[model samples]
Target: MAESTPGFELPLLLFAGFRSIVDQLHAELARQGHPDVRPAHGFAMQAIGRDGATASELGRRLGVSKQAAGKTADRLAALGYAVRVDDPADARRKVIRLTPHGYDVLARSAAVFEELRTAWAERLGEERLRQLEADLRTMAPPSGFRLDVAGWFGA
Candidate 1:
């Protein structure tokens, strides 16, 4: 066989690239004054955006247990990024919603992600990055197929 790329295998390269992206994401969050934010919370953050939902609902959406989602919500509450309030239609149940701070963080993080994507576009031409993104989406492994905590987070 002719020589292949003299570097890591494809799967290993993909994994390393993903890890690097997540690392950059966390660094951006911290640099934006969200030191308490974490990769784990990224799931909770998306799940609890805008109108928000019950902890149970969040758990279901994230494919995590209700207890795990509750704990994450608790952490967000403690950080002043989220608040648990009585559900309007059902006082017995609580809903987690993003605080003003949380909304700001969300907006800022979106900009950070754009910056990261732009950097990638610079490395590989914008058109190439667009094709790569489409290819990744088309070839992405099934969500249920993931076995790591990172699986809880979305693309």
Candidate 2:
């Protein structure tokens, strides 16, 4: 007998399935009264926190068009989650900084993520959770593989 390819392990399908589950989780967040924030907002928040960055810089980091990043910034600004200030180093550029409310929201989101992760671990059991984590880490590219629980659980 020949070695068989594992069924349902196609990378794209796996990613899509995970995405659906994430969508459900986000829906729960929204139901819990989180302000209808998109995945893009979460990505933008992470980028801004990592680097005191300009919108164009965020666009570059996210592999999105500058206009798209600007639009995202606009939404954040309108929601009072961020403000764009003239960059001191470069007059031509502006940097996006989180507002107090944004920081609060981010902190709450962190707590929620921790709670969810703990619940998930409880459901999966320690050994199975560890195995699932290891498998996912192996699948990720070397450069993208972040071993930190924060990165794994996306807080």
* Top TM-score prediction, candidate number: 1
Q: Which candidate number has the best lDDT?
A: 1
**Sliding window of 10 residues with minimal summed lDDT for model 1:** 145-154
Model-by-model lDDT, in order? 0.82, 0.71
Estimate the lDDT of model 2.
Answer: 0.71
Query: Candidate 2 at 113: error in angstroms?
Result: 1.7
